[model samples]
Target: MKYKPHEQGFSILEMLVAMSITIGLTGTLFYFFKQSQDSFVVESARTEMNQNFRAALDLMARDIQAAGAGIPMFLGPIASKDGGGTNSNPSLNPPDAILLLYGNSSFSPVTVKAQSSYPAPTSTSSTIYTDIPTTAFAPGNYILYTPAQSLMQASNLTDYAEFSLFNLPSTSAIGTVSSGGTVIGNQLTPSTFSINPSDDNTYWNHTMSFPSSTSLRVVPLDEVIEYAIDTTSSELRRNRNKAGWVTVARNIFNMQVRYQIETYDDSTATYTASWIDQVNQAATNNRALIRSVEVTLFGRTQMSGSGDRQGQRAIAQTLEVAPRNLNLPGFAPNR
Candidate 1:
């Protein structure tokens, strides 16, 4: 027989020791991996929250800067509706509401082209003849009409009427393509417009009647914009032209608004500007004196925090904006 070498193998104690060491290493690695994943999740949530907050803030600020632009001072370009959560904490309740009014540059006074009321006031037919160009106005659009007489007499907006344009007679005022059915051209003709009727009680029709070629003040309905935070959804909403509430930002808790009024004292040659809130008595008396607006926003984090990070779960910020178009002394002709 050949000389046999003794078989050298691991002893049971040695094997047990090696296996224990391997298991401990694996357990440590797994624990480290779990911790890293948790950290990543938390950080990702925070990053997303910050991004949303920045975007929402930028949009609101931009709009606030542009508020009251091309709008009349008598129209109350900026109006605030207070959401009464102050008896309790505002953060525990809903946010305040604000309305900003601006103007459409394209809006103008249009003369009724029809000699007689083409569609009778009582007639449900959606039709009106105007001196607007055929291509200037499009079907499926909306027109906010304010009767000239009503606007002169009324203190409120009860006389305003908003109508959706129906099928308007198309004209090839511009060169039309051979393939395309009709490329309407622009012409200041007596264009016929059959607009969608709203209700029975529009003051323009119910109250006053206009002569042929009478001028009607046509306005863009969306000039009035409303911003509010919904308590149920915890989302910031924007509603324009009563088109319905559109969610603009999420994870928002509360919003408070205040106006800074500037009262110039000629005696002292100084201006005293005081910030007034809805609850203050001076708000109503000095609404027209508003020179700037102060907004407070409270935001909530997506992730819940523990002991060390508890305060990070909620954040509050204040933004003060001075609109360029308001509280200024200027004469705007034919605005």
Candidate 2:
């Protein structure tokens, strides 16, 4: 047969080379696209973890600052456990639990009513009545403040009466506010009421009265706030008083707290603060010595990534917060 240029076709070797070049270009493009997608996903996961860590820390900081608010110095303000407090046999990586005490100043104002036949505070009895339902008092220590009845005219020593709601006639739950605001049965105190007339310098006797009748302000000393991390669930939880635990943040891997103790150097005439773990300070009976707290929270991504790409990455945040009420004069002992 006679071969013509127009009828010519490529040999097998030439066709093979052309196919190889096309495959190489396609493979390179695919590789680049996959890498870009993976990077985007990893970045998104880290952003989510970082947001969760910040939220958890902000919630904790606000509550810590409220310690000892509206309550007398006699009551212990801050306490903490190195390991889990509620969990008896804690896990290998158990997070710390911190206890904070502050008055529920946010609660509705309740007034002492003479119409209910509420008697004046006496050395023998310290019972008082409020116009609101007994449920208004979250069964714990409370202060009866009669601002008009100060110990001295020009002094800051006002007549602040301290009493336990459990000591009242009928208080069922020790630290819960039930429906209808009424105290039903008498339950023993779970937390201590340390402010007594003999010991508490702020305690005094006064026959408080109002315009037409007599009234006194009922301020709660019962709010017990606690924060803990659930390692198993990777969540941060909080409980108020004797209430159930509420989740503050999810995908939280770890939580740690350190307390700051203020020490005054007599020779230097200066105050120096030291940060110590909860275990070391356990021997000291001074919760008031805790001037501030440092909190560290570690969070992890929920999603899992493939080989060489960790779907989960950890992010951490640290914050320091001072309890304003505790730093006030006469709040801390030996100050």
Cα error of candidate 2 at position 85, Å = 15
User: Could you tell me every candidate's TM-score relative to the true structure?
Assistant: 0.55, 0.61
Model 2 lDDT tens row, 138-232: 54455444323311111122212223322232355333222377643222233324322123222211111111224445556657677877778
| Per-residue alpha-carbon lDDT of candidate 1 for residues 1-335, written as tens digits (9 for 90 to 100) | 89988969999999999999999999999978977876776777767767767777777787777775543332234656566565556566556767665655555434433345332111223344444442255422233233333122212222211122222334432122122565322222223232111212231132112222233333333355667887787787787655678887788878888877655554575656566664221322233456688887777777764633433456667788877665353333234
For model 2, the superposed segments whose C-alpha errors exceed 4 Å read 1-7, 84-93, 106-219, 265-270, 279-285, 329-335
Q: Spell out the clash pairs found in candidate 1.
A: 173-185, 174-185
Model 2 TM-score, all chains together: 0.61
* Candidate of highest TM-score: 2
Judged by whole-model lDDT over C-alpha atoms, candidate 1 comes out at: 0.52
Give the distance in Å from residue 3's predicted Cα in candidate 1 to where it truly belongs: 21
Compute the lDDT of residue 77 as modeled in candidate 1. Answer: 49
- Candidate 2 lDDT score at position 275: 77
List the global CA lDDT of all models: 0.52, 0.56
lDDT of 2: 0.56
Worst 10 residues of 2 by lDDT: 204-213
